[model samples]
Each structure stands twice: as C-alpha cells, then as structure tokens.
Target chain A: MISQFIFIIILGAAVYLFGKNVAKVRRNILLGKDTDRSDNPAERWKLMAKVALGQSKMVKRPTAAVLHLFVYVGFVIINLEVLEIMIDGIFGSHRVFAGPLGGLYGLLIGSFEVLAFLVLASCVIFLVRRNVVKLKRFTGTEMTAWPKSDANYILITEILLMAAFLTMNAADYKLQALHVGHYVTAGSFPVSALIAPLLPAGAGALEAIERGCWWFHIIGILAFLNYLPYSKHFHILLAFPNVYYSNLNAKGKFSNMASVTNEVKAMLDPSFVPETTEVSRFGVKDVTDLTWKNLMEAYTCTECGRCTSVCPANITGKLLSPRKIMMDTRDRLVELGNNIDKHGKDHTDDKSLLDNYITREELWACTTCNACVEACPVNINPLEIITEMRRYVVMEESQAPASLNNMFGNMENNGAPWKYSQADRFNWAEKG
Target chain B: MELNIPTMAQMVAEGKTPEILFWVGCAGSFDERAQKITRDICKILQHVGISYAVLGTEESCTGDPAKRAGNEFLFQMQAMANIELLNAYEVKKIVTGCPHCFNTIANEYPGLGGTYEVIHHTQLIQGLINDGKLKAEGGESFKGRRITFHDPCYLGRGNGVYEAPRAALEVLDTELVEMKRCKTNGLCCGAGGAQMFKEPEKGNKDINDERMVDVIEAKADVIASGCPFCMTMLSDGVKHLNKEQDIKVLDIAEITVRANGL
Candidate 1:
C-alpha cells in the first residue's frame, strides 16, 4: 500500500513537470509572428502519416532508415508493457491481466521482449556509429560539445532502459518457474528465457532483482520524458507537426510579403494609397520576427547534417551550414525564452540570431538551393530562415553587398538585372 | 525557314492572340551568348508551326534576382508591372527560356494577382517531340559522344521538371550521362540567388568550379543545359578548366534545333 502511494506521487510529479516544460516550449514557439498553416487539412494529414509516422523520407538513406525503424518501432510497442506495469503499480496486483488475458498476454509480452532485445542491439550499433565510425554528417563544427554528448546520452539512456526491462522479465520468468507466491506464469519470454538461467536460483534474490528492475524501468521512462525538451531528441514529438506544416508549394515559391506589396504599390502608382499599419520590421533579425512555424522548425531540428553534407556552399568550403542555422536559431530562442522567464516578457537582449550566432559571411554564402529542405528527414526548411535573415540584412539596414546594389539598381531603373534598355528586349527577334 | 516572331503588342494591334507568349527573360534578351539560345527557341516554335509571340519591350525582369537577394519590394514592383502588362495582353499560355523567370513569374507572380500557364522552353520542346511535331531527322549525329545534362537548380529542384530536359535529349543519337549530383540531388552552379550579379563569398573553390568536378567525372563530351544561367556557368567552367575544345555547353533548345535540322 505504501509502495503504491509512492508510485502515484512520482508519476504525478513527473507528468506535471513534463507538461510544464512542454508548455513553456509551446509559449516560446508562439512568441513569433502568426501564419495560418491549418488550411490544407487533407494533404497535411497524408503528409504527416507518410513522412513522420511512416518514416518515408528516412528511407533515402537506407542504412540509417532500417536501423531507426527498429528503435522507433521497439520503443513505441514496448511502452505498451508500461500500461500493464502501471496497473500493477496502482492496484498492488501481480500480472492483473494474467487470468483474464490467458494466451494473448503471453504473445503480446513475447513480441515486446523480442522488440526490447532489438532496441538494445540497435542502440549499441548507433553508439558505435556515432562514437567510433564518426559519420561526417554528425561531426559538423556546430555539433561540438553538448550536441554530440546529448546524442550519446540519449542512446545510452535507451540502452539502459531496455536492459532493465529485459532483466526484469528474465527474473520474473525465473520466479514463475519456481511457482513463487504472486509470481504469475503469464508472459512468454523468448529473450528473457535465455537470461533466466543466468539469474540466481534463489527466489528471494530473483524477486529483489525483478522488483528493482521494474521500479528502475518506469523511473527511467519518466526521466526520459523530461529530458526530451532539453535535447535534440525532442524531434520524436515535434517531427509529426513539423512535417504536416512543411511548405507544400513548389520549391521555387518564396512567399511574397503583403506589407512590402502595399508599400511598393503605393510607391509605383500616384493614385494608390498604402494600407495603414504599424511600421513593421522588414525581415527576421531575431526570433520574434519569424513565423511561428519557423520557430517550431528551430525546436524540431534533430541536428542531422544531411542538409550540410549536400549543401553547395558547404560542399565547396563555405561558412554556411543549414544545420548550424537551425541550431543557432533554437539556441537564440531558448536564450530569449529564458530572459523573458527571468526578467519578464518586456526584457530586451543585445544578442540576436544574426551576428551573435549566425554570421554575415555565413548568411551571404548560401545559394538558396533547396537541397537542405529536400534532405531533411523531418522536412525542416532552413532556407526560409536564411532568406529571412538575408532580408533583414538588405531591407532593414540597407547594407546589401555593393555588387548586389548595382543589380538592384539595374532592376529598378532599367527593368533588368543588367544595364540594358527595354527597347532592345525585342532586338533578339531582329534580322542581323 | 524565316523565323516569325511578333511582339504581343503587335499581335494585339492585329487583333491576334497567339498560342503562347514567349517570356524572353533579361539574360535571353541581353546576354550575347544567351541570345543564341533565345533565337533557337524562336526557331523551334516556328518549325513546329505553333502560334507564339514575344513580350518584347512589354517584358521586363521577373525580379528573381532582387527577390532572391531579399529585396521583395523591387521584386513585387517588377512583378506587378509585368503582371499588369501580361494581363493586358490577356496572355493565357506562356513560355520562358530562363528557369529563374519561369520560377518567379509562374510560382511567385500568381500570389500577387497574376497567373498564367507557364512552361519552360525545355518543357515546350519536350511537348513538341511528344506530339510528333518535331524530330531529329537529318541532324548531327552525337553517336559515340558522351553528353551530360546539368540539371539547372531552378528547373529541376525548384519546379520539378527533371524528365522534360532529358526527353529533349532522348531524340538525339548520343549517350546521356548523369553527373554524380544530378536531378534533385544536383549541385548549384554558383549563379543562383543573385550570385550571378556578385562575387562569391570566401570559399575553398568557386561553386561552378566545384560543379565542373562532376562534369569531368561524368566524362561528358557535351554539356546540355536547360537554363541560360546554367549555360553561362557550365560554359565558363569548361573554359576555366581549358576543356572548351573537349566539351560543348549547348542549351537544350540549340541541341533540339540542331537535332531536328530546323
């Protein structure tokens, strides 16, 4: 009875704290400007199912895709066992469904046991891939320190959690054979059956290991739930909505600014009057200028450098890296979020996403190729942020590169990017 | 055969609305090298006996350069003026020699109250081939020569028109080699996003030169391009590497014209 009371309190506190952290992230994402993404209900759902749920994009890299499937499928299905564990925790019963479920319970637990074992193998392989093999995409300059360690920590945590789960099952299987009190012969343990012989024959020792592992497994999951918002592993939750809200239009379409449209029309025509609105900053200098979807993208980045690896600028040794842009945006957003949390919403910061995190050179190097957009397994659009920052650099400050200024002048005065008379536009049609 | 290219204004004055209004972009109209491709496109239309007219003086920049450089104000201004002119002509169908113009005017202009059936020149040529209006009869044989199609970023990745350019090449009697980075995975030619107007940022190598590595690896005897910007970049790359004699960077329209003996 006392143990059940403690279990409820721990579960309650964990859920409350996790909910609070996720809510804070939601608030931070909503701090940005609003743009409607809720229009295409049917398409968004289909895309979400394919890209996020089906892991369709991940299959582009076959090795990673297959490995990721094992872990993802295993983790989600194994958590079903947690439901049984929770009932046992709350009701102070041993395998409460054992009598009612009969044979099906054994099959369900058998599948989970096999899945748990696969999850363990996949995690170990991933750890080696990260630490030993050191894939080029994982070793970008921005992936230094915390980013690298965070990946390792998640993998290690998952491995430990799976280990505890399997150990708990193995001990329980051993105890069931001995016909110990309340140690129900319920689950078919294909994986744990092997480990059952390794466990001590003494029923008391086995009970202690089983009970200890059971407690450790649930606590580990609760802790992992909290750890998500702090790490790049947050992608597990955010990937679904992010893929749904991804730009569905042609890759060529950079959305037109309505404010710019109003201002430009008023300038072009003598009779035209601009719609009156508060003077808006031209482009994204900070997180606040970005669309909420862009902010959501920042938080959703998994820091996989498939984008950087394929980027034309980055490929040719340019400072620009799409993955770094996402990381910097998220870092800046978190910094701003913390500032608002401590010093209230009105508090200001000298540091911005530009200059402080992403540099002028880095911003200029991008070719705006959609390789990054296409390469992202999560369907994150880093090009949108890069262009928005480029807008801030050009429109807000009037600090465009001198050559681009000449090009802009040509477009404005001569109706072309180069200095050529419009009269000669038809010159190509004339007989030489 | 004499090329019959009428201005939309001239066509309108004659109470004639042609089939497709040709959007001869800034590069096609002005750039000396690109002008050749422009003429060949007009030649292809005339050969196919399709009723088409040029925007001529009525045409201006699509503002792709300004828009990409983050000057949306200039972009919309150019776009609005062009849209007003295009709408005045009641242009129903449109074609462009430049992918930049095709992308901006087709994709970006529609939101600003201008929409038309826009097709890239390669797509137009592909349609002509598919309809049996064009053929490779009595044309230069590319037999035993390797030709690679450098998928222009705007045309392929931007608009998803990968097969059309390749289809134009299919009528030719040659080996079509794909670069290591081709189609959606294709690398940029260091000329996108207003990069054509300015010097590249400090890097180990120029992006075009980097793209040339793919060209060299493909062992291409000729580089067929669909975009004018790509033609300039790929041609310059050949020249830079002193492979000018080795590789001929011809636009798809030029190759089509040469292939069909038009």
Candidate 2:
C-alpha cells in the first residue's frame, strides 16, 4: 500500500511537469499568425500514415533506415510493457495480465525482450554513427556544444532506459526462481534470462536490484517525457501532426498572399477603390509574421540534417543549410516565447528572426528546389520559411540583389522579365 | 522546320476559335536559344494539325521570375495584367514550352481567378504521340543515339510529373538514359528561384556544373530537357566543359521535331 502510494505521487508529479513543458511549447507555436491547413482531411491523414507511421522517407538511407526502424518500432511498441508497469505500480499487482493472458502474455513479453535488445543495439550503433563515425551531416558548424550533446543525451538516455528494463526483468526472473514474496513466475524473459545467471544469487540482493532497476527505468522515462519539449527529439510527438498538416499543394506552387491579391484586384478594377490605409509590412519579418504552419514546422524539425544532406545548395558548398534554417527559427521562437513570458504582451524586442538569426546571404543561397522539403522525413518545409524571409527582404525593404532589382524593374515596365517591349514578343516567330 | 504561327488577334479576326492558346513565355519569346524551342513547338503543332494561336504582343510575363525573386507585389501586378488579358480573350487550354510559365499559370494563377487548362508542351507532345496525331520513327541521326533527359524540378518534383516527358522521349528511337538523380529526387539546374537573374553566391562549384557531372557520367550524346530555363543552364554547363560541340542540349519538342522531320 505504501509503495503504491509513493508510485502514485511520483507519477502525478512527472505528469504535471511533462504537461507544463508541452503546454509551453504549444503556446510558443500559437505566437505566430494563423494560416489555414485544416482543409483536406483525408489527404492529411494519408500523409501522416505514410510519412510518420510508415517511415516512408526514412528508408532513403537504407542502413540508417533499418537501424532507425528497429529503435523506432521498439520505442513505440515497448511502451505497452510500460503501460503494464504503470498499472502494476498503481495497483500493487505482480504480473497482473499473466493470469488471464496465459501463453499470449509470454509471447508478448518474449517479443518485447527481443525488441528491447534490438533497441539497445541500435542506440549504441547510432551513438557510434554520431560520435565515432562522425558523419559529415552530424558534425557541422550548427551541431556544436548543446545540439551535439543533446543528440548524444537522447540516445544515451534510451540506452540506459532499455538497460534498466532488462536488468529489472533479469533480477525479477532470479527472484521468481527463488520463489520470493510477490515475485510471480510471469513474463518469459528470453533475453533477460541470460542475465539472470550473472546476477548476485541471494533473495535480498535480487529484490534490491530489481526494485532499483524498476524505479530507475520509470523515473528515466518520465524525465525523457519532460525533456522532449526542450529537445529536437520533440519530433517524436510532433512528426505525426507535422506530416498531417504538410502543404498538399504541388511543390512548385507558391502560396499567394491574399492581401496582396486583394490589393491587386482593387488596382485592376475601377469600381473597387482600395481604402487608403497606413503602410503595412509585407511578407514575414518576425516570428509572429510567419504562418502557424511555418512555426509548427520549426518545432517539428528533428535536427537529423537529412534535409541539409540532400540539399543541392548545401551539397555544392553553399552557406544555406536547411537544417540551420529550422534550428534558427526554433531558437528564435524560444527566445520570443521567453521574452513574452518575462515582459508581457506589450514588450518589444530589438532583434527579429531575419538578420538576427538567419542572414541575408543564407536566405539568397536557397534555390527553392523543394529538395529540402522532400528530403525531410517528417515533411517540414524549410523552403517556405526561406522564401518568406526573402519576400520580406525584397518586398518590405526593397533589398534584393542588384540583378534581381533590374529584373523586377523590367517586369514592372514591360510585360516580360527582359527589356524587350510587348510588341517585340512575337519577333521570335517572325525570325528566318 | 519553319512555320507561320498565327496570333490570337489574327485567329479572332479570322473568326476561328482555336483549340489551344500557345503561351510563348518570356524566354521562349526573347532568348535566342529558347526561341528555337518555340519554333520547334510551333512546327510540331502545325504538323499535328492542332489549331493553336499565340497571344503575341498581348501575352505578358507570367510573373514566375518576379514571384520567385520574392517580389510578390511585382508578381501580383504582372499576374493580374496577364490574367485580365487572358480572361478578356476567354482563353482556355493553354500550352507553354517553359515549365516555369506552365507551373505558374496552371497552379499559381488559379487563386487569382486566372484558372485555365494549362499544359506543358512536353505533355502536349506526349498526348499527340499517344493520340496518333504525330509519329516519331527513328530518324537517321537520332536512331538509338544516347540521349539522357534532365528532369526539371518544376516539372518533376514540383508538379509530380515524371512520366510524361519520358514517354515523349520514349517515342524517339534513342537510348533514353537517366542521371544518377532523376524524377522526384532530381537536382536543380541552378536557375530556379530567380537564380538565373543573379550570380550565384561563392561556392565550391556551380549547381549546373555539379549537374553536368551527372550528365557526363550518364555518357549521353544529347541532353534532353523539358524546361527552357533548364535548357539554358545545362547548355551553359555543357559549354563550360567545352563539350557543347560534342553533346547537344535539345528540348523535348526540338527532339520530337527532328525525330518526326516535322
């Protein structure tokens, strides 16, 4: 009864902390302007299934894909065991489902053990890939200090969590062999059974080890849950929604600003005189200027650098890394969120996301090729964000490159992008 | 291959409603090299007996360059003017040799009440071949010649069209090779997003040069492309390598015209 009470108190506290962090991130995303992505429910659901659940894009890199698949599937499916543990902790029950589930419970437990081992192996391999193999995409300028440590931290945490679960199972198996109190002959620990022989061979030693492992594993999971909102690993939760809300329009199609369209319509029509209003900023200048979906994209970035890796601009040694674009947005958003929290709604900041975070050089380097958008396993559109910043630079500040300004002038005066008059448009066909 | 292409105003004066309006884009109109593609498309249209008329001087820029350059205001102004003109003409079933113009007119223009049945010239040629309107038997020069098609981002990944251009290429009796990255995973030719108007930032190598590496690896005698912008970039790439004389960069329409002797 005392243990159950202690379990309830700890679980409640973990839940509270996890909920607070998740809520804060949600509020941060809502700081941006609204944009409708609510249309096309069926297509959105299909995308979620294929991209997130199916891991369709992850398999582009075969070795990493397979390794990631094991870890991913294990992380998701092994949680069923966590569910059982939670119930057991609350109710003070020993192997609660084993009595009714019979051999099926054994089969499930056996599968969980195999997956746990696979997850552990994959985590170690992933650690090696990041720290030892030193993949070019992983060890970039943006991936220094905290970003690098954060990735290693997540992998290490998962490794320890899986280790704890297996250790607890191994000790429990030994306790069951000794017919100790509350130690039922329940889960068939196929993988953990090997460790049973290695454990110290006394009842008191076994009980202490089992309880320590059990408590540590649960607490570790709780810590991971709270850490997600602060880490790029937040993609674990956001990937589904991000993929679902992905832009369903053709990749080449740029979204037209309705305000600009309306203004243009008014200009074209003599009857509808546009109301004279004060100068409003055009395009995205700050976090709040971006659409809600764009903000959500920043939060959904996994920092895996797949988009950066496949980027033609980056591959050709350009300054623009799509991953860096997302990271900058997310970091700026966090700053904005913290500022709003500290200073209230009326407070202003000297810095904006454009020059303060992403530079003009990086913005112009993008080709808008949709490669970054396509390469993202979770369907984040970095091109959209880059384009928005470029729009701000050109439309708001009129700071386009001299060549682009020349083209813009040509477009404004003549009907075409060149200096040729409209009368000369047909001159090509008149040629010999 | 020379043919007299009539204007929309001339077609109206003749009291005829053509089946399609040929949207000869800015590059197709002015660029000396892209003009060849325009002429070849005209020849193919004339040979296939598909009644098509151009807007001629009435046609303006589709504002793709402006939109991509982040000048939304300029793009909107240009788009509205072209839309108003097209609406006045009641034009439907538009076709363009440039994928940039096709992408903008088909996808972007609809939101501004400028929707029309816009199709790329490659798609039109593919349709014509499929409809038995045009025949592309192995010509003397192009028979089993090594031809590699560079997938334009706007056509392939942008619009989810990977097959139509290839199908058009398939009709020609040439060895159709593919680059290392093709279709959905194809690389850009360093021209999209208004990059053509400005010099590229300092980098190890130009994107066109990198793409040229793929073309060279594919060992293609002729690099076939669907977009005129891509044609220009790839042609420059070929010229940079001084392989221009050896490897010809031809539009799919140009290839078809040569293949059919239209």
Best by lDDT: 1
List the RMSD of every prediction in angstroms. Answer: 1.5, 1.6
Per-residue lDDT of model 2, residues B199-237, tens digit only: 897789999999998998999989989988898899899
> B142, model 2: CA deviation in Å?
2.5
lDDT string, candidate 1, B174-217, tens digits = 89999999988899898998889988998898888999999999
Q: lDDT at B3 for candidate 2? A: 90
Give the poorly placed runs of model 1, Cα more than 4 Å off: none
Q: What is the lDDT of candidate 2?
A: 0.89
Alpha carbon lDDT at A204, candidate 2: 100
The CAPRI class of candidate 2 is: high
